[model samples]
Target: NLRVHLLEVEESVDRVFSDDSTKKAVNLLYMYPNGVNTVSSDIQGLTESSTNLGVVTTLENSIEYDSTARSS
Candidate 1:
């Protein structure tokens, strides 16, 4: 299960990653969290900024951003 998701098959691994790279995949045992603090702080800042801007403006901005960033 995890092996397939991790691309344990040789051809699958080769197709996904460069042959010269040292690491092609990591097992659950090696997976670790490192960026939670930075992301949490950014989210808190967005919440505070949105509160100052009011909900209507924030929602309109979000809708405009989504429309601009997406294409048919």
Candidate 2:
């Protein structure tokens, strides 16, 4: 189940980053102070929607998934 969740996160990240609607390149670093790293992405452009920040929203959702998985 954990593996499946992780795969889902991977796919979500890939899909969001690969989207062509994004305009400015950005990097997302998912790291822990304890030196544990889960996921990171250095990709080109974020979505152009000013009111709807797609990257941030997606990352937040990803973090929620991570938290839920951790608790389980």
TM values, all candidates: 0.16, 0.13
lDDT of 1 by residue, 15-71 (tens): 333343324223212342222222235445432211111111223112111111111
lDDT of 2: 0.28
Model 2 CA lDDT for position 35: 23
Worst 10 residues of 2 by lDDT: 63-72
* Cα-based lDDT at residue 68, candidate 2: 17
- Steric collisions counted per model: 0, 3
Sequence-dependent TM-score of model 1: 0.16
By lDDT, who's the top model here?
2
